[model samples]
Target: MSDSGPTIVLLGAGHAHLGVIDDWLKHGSPPVRTILVEPRDAMQYSGMVPGWMAGEYRDEETRIALAPLVREARIDWRRCRAVGLDPVSREVLLETGERIAFDVCSIAIGGAGRAENLVGRDPRLIDIRPIDGFIERWSEAEDTAPPRRIAVIGGGAGGVELAFGARNSTSQPDVLLIAGEHGLIPGHPAAARRVVERELESQKITVLTGEAQLDDDGALTVGDKAIEPFDAILAAVGSGAPSWPRESGLPVDEDGFIRVGPTQQVEGLPHILAAGDVARRTDVRVRHSGVHAVYAGPVLATNLRRLIAGRSDLATYSPFGKDFYLFNTCRGTSILSYGAFGLKARWLRRLKDWLDRRWIARFSGR
Candidate 1:
């Protein structure tokens, strides 16, 4: 290492970067001068966000204090969004027009919820990926009179969870879930899907399966049929890659997600690395979930440290074939799924709560 160590910049305070901060706290900081760039001082743990929405936990329970972690790790914290990156000059341009250079950079900004295309320019659309904003809107909605009907777009786990959360949080009994043609959680086993479908029925939520779009007046149109006007629209659809990566001239997938090899290093750009939803592994098809991001964190940290210290022996990320997923129904029960098998019970809900709390405790320094 040189007299002044390499400047390592962490682009986002997502799950993977949280793991990096945890590692640094435990093993002592790396030799390099580390910097963390994120607009928010705290990051909400997505796993417990449904619980918060369902009134099972307080709002503060879902947040992890990022400022404390950055302070403890001796990292320079920038409370701003990165608007652009100049790879040729190795500088990250901030929204405030400040250019910060880095010898090595890791992008973990997560994915962007493309609400514009789904809602057709609707003015009253709320997306769930950026949990902070969603939580704020949810609070405002809760404070006001409950809507007669609310529509949740997307059939994946996020959509299902949000539908249940909204049901638990509101006095309105009419919650509708609109999914794609494959139905709820199409990638999961049939049994798992059945559990969610049955719960939706039991909760009195209507399920609409097909492509859907919002009309100019904010009405949901599903395959030539226009449904009743929804008072509120919650979008839990899967996220798309942010624009910065593609505009940065980095190698990215069709969706604009940065492409990485097995080592989590951006293809054709060894100095730049990425993980979490913002990154796609070229070797294998990985789902964009918190599970994959949290698991990839340690490997990312190790590889970055090695590269900084002039070590050729770097670690590679091997994605899991089958991972355990817990879905909180927000109705006093939860569902656990692994491969083709699934289980739903109150005990599983307790387990999910414990696991989520423990994970958050790590970063919260509790």
Candidate 2:
């Protein structure tokens, strides 16, 4: 075996990359030169964000710093963002006007919050993706007089948690949830939806069932009705990919997310891989969440190592059979959902808090 293999670029400090680093830390040093490209030294764990919004967690608790992991694994840390990818040349272009060539690459840059109609029309609206940005904006917003009328768009898990968490906060701004055409928690099981629906009613938050569109004046219309003006608006409609990857000529699904197979390899580019929200599985339908991302991490690490070693055999990513979830609620309670099974209780909130802290602590090295 060669003492050193090819250079592998680890793009974005997302969950999957953490697994790769953790694997290297415990098992062995990186088999090849590794460089991590990210704009921030640390990233917020999406799971605990709802709790943070509800005043259950401090700012520091939600962050997982990259320094300790990188130092332990001996991976080069690039404190900048990747602006472009040239797969044809196997190089990543950084925002700092530098281009680094790589023999293999893995992207975990995460996805942008889908705010196509809501946030684009209203610049003041906050988006839930790029988690750190949302946290910063919301924290600043909370410092001033709380917005009396608040509107949260979307009905997915993130949207539901944000709506309920906002209502639970000390400010307790009146929250209006635009559940969209499919209604509350559309893809979740019947029982889970019912539990969340009951929680919303108990919180006294307004629910609008229909598609949310913006008029010319930045006003919102739900189906056929006009809603009251909101001093604060948040969009958690779901995630969308950045335009650069597609522009770079990488294969992507209709939504612009990089198309990756079971091995986390970009279609037609086996040497380049992607995972997490920024990547969409083409072989199977998989739900996008922090849970799935974490599950795919070890697979990503294994496959990346194989590619770097010039080996054809690689590992594949498979989703867990039953992934459980918890949603933050009022009065230090939470909604626990696992397929058809679901519950709402104060003790469940403690469990969710412990799980979030545990996940963060796993990599925090603090």
Candidate 3:
């Protein structure tokens, strides 16, 4: 953290950036000045969120305060959002109009959900992106108008987990999952789909297959059909990249996420790198997930350190095995899936809890 050497700006206190900081804590930070800029004071680990929603864990059990971690790590933490960027000049524009320059940078801000038309339709409408807000809004909703019939949008892992969590609520509300155009899990095998379908039937969660949209009156509109109304809506559909990356002229995929190489380096910009939901690996088609980000953290950290130390050799992030994929059912059981294989088990619930807690423990003293 020298004031005179090169500067590396680690934007967004995402899972991967936290990994970089932990590396500094263990092996000592690089001599280069390190700056960590993120607006949020705490990050609610997405892995444990479903469990918390199901009343299986407390609020504190799932979140880590960023202030302490940044303070202990001695990082130059900025409590402001980044509104813009200029990769050509190596500068990050802050929401406060302050521009930060860096010799190297890594962008790990989480994805941005499509929330244009759906938000203001109703007070009960909730989109699950920008997770911190979701937690806060959920708290308000819980204390006020706790929903009796909950509709979970999206068929991905997040939506599926939300459906189960809602079902396990204290009130035991009716849960309906609108899986969008792709029914249930699209990439999973037919056998895995059957396993999930069986669970949904056993749990009494109704499943709808079609793309869902918000109508003028905040109703769930699917093409020409108006779906049955629910007391609350939770949109867990996947998110695309935020606007700043593309506005800053950085190379992005069709979805607007930065494209990185095998070594986690930004596609054309070697001095800059990205990981987690904000980046897509160019060499391999890796689905964005917290599991991948947590595993790739070490590789991202190593590369950032190497560049500062004048080392030519950098580490590559290899995707781990499918055994790590665990989806909570909130039925005292969880589903494990990788490639074409999927299964649900009660012990898998304990395994999911252990894995989630272990990851959070590494970054917690608070």
lDDT (Cα, tens digit) per residue for candidate 1, span 138-162 = 7887788666688888899899998
Each prediction's total of clashing residue pairs, residues at least 3 apart in sequence or on different chains, is: 0, 0, 1
Write the residue-wise lDDT of candidate 3 on 1-366 in tens digits.
223568899999888888888888888888778899898878889988777888999998898788878777778998888888787888889999998888888888889876544333566678888788888887777778778898888888788888888888777789989888878977767666777888888999999888777777767776668876788888887876898888888899887899999888888898889998989988888778887787778888899889878787999888746325678888788887777778889998899889888978988884
**Distance (Å) between predicted and true CA of 283, model 1?**
1.1
Judged by whole-model lDDT over C-alpha atoms, candidate 2 comes out at 0.85
Candidates' C-alpha lDDT: 0.85, 0.85, 0.83
Full candidate order by TM-score, most accurate first: 1, 2, 3
Query: Total backbone clashes of model 1?
Result: 0
Q: Write the per-residue lDDT of candidate 2 for residues 285-364, one digit (tens) a residue.
A: 88788888888889988887787777899998877573678888846888888877779999998998888888887887
The Cα error of candidate 1 at residue 182, in Å, is 2.3
Better-scoring candidate (lDDT), 2 or 3: 2
The TM-score, computed over Cα atoms with residue i paired to residue i, of candidate 3 is 0.94
Candidate 2 error regions (>4 Å) = 1-5, 116-120, 320-322
